[model samples]
Target: MTKYLISFEKGAMDHIPEADWPEVGKAARAVCDEAKDAGVFVFADGLRYDDGDVQHAVVDVDGVVTDGPYPESKELIGGVLIVDVPMREEALRWAAKTAAACRCAQDVRKFIDGPNNA
Candidate 1:
């Protein structure tokens, strides 16, 4: 089994109206349930959008520590789902389902050395 990450960029769903969130949440939860039923779900979570609640930590080679997210990137990971699947195609299929459920595009990528990897 290979572990894949299925995620979407922060603010990708900003256009969604607040009134429709319940429906969207339902759809997203359904996908998660399906994944769990299929025995592919490893873990999943959504991040808080508030910057005040988010703290970034960086450790330097000499053990120096800094705070803040990457200065060059505007996009953030809004949510993520990790799954252990047999192949890339299977991961892509899950990503498609997730995209539809979230009403946003998803980015799928395999982990270099995941839990299932020896």
Candidate 2:
């Protein structure tokens, strides 16, 4: 099986109508259910707005953890899903399904080959 990084680009959802947001949530849940039924879902979750937490963090040298996000940026991670699929096609299909359900763009790309990958 292959792992993929499926993400929406920053500002990708701007075109969606406000009235459709609830429907997007419903669609996302449905896709999650479909993934589970297919036995390809590893994990999936939505993210909460954490910009305040990030702004408060102050990291120090020596890789020490501090009070806030390391750096401030306009764009931060929104949410994510991780899935194990038999091939890239399957991963792309899942991403397409997610995009349709969320009513936002979802990009699907293979996880790079690296050490310690299962």
Q: Write the per-residue lDDT of candidate 1 for residues 1-118, one digit (tens) a residue.
A: 8899999987899999999999999999999999999999999989775768655566889999876575665567899999899999999999999999999999999999844475
Winning model by lDDT: 1
Q: Could you tell me the TM-score of candidate 1?
A: 0.87
Could you tell me which 10 consecutive residues in candidate 1 have the lowest summed lDDT?
67-76
- Give the distance in Å from residue 57's predicted Cα in candidate 1 to where it truly belongs: 2.8
Give the Å error, residue 83, model 2.
1.4
What lDDT would candidate 1 get against the real structure? 0.89
Q: Write candidate 2's Cα lDDT for 2-114 as tens digits.
A: 77877775456668899988887888888888888988887777654455544444446877767544355634545567778878888988988888877677877787666
lDDT score of residue 89 within candidate 2: 85
The local lDDT score (0 to 100) that residue 84 gets in candidate 2 is: 83
Q: In model 1, what is the error at residue 8, expressed in angstroms?
A: 0.7
Per-prediction TM-score: 0.87, 0.72
lDDT of each: 0.89, 0.73
Off by over 4 Å in 1: 114-116
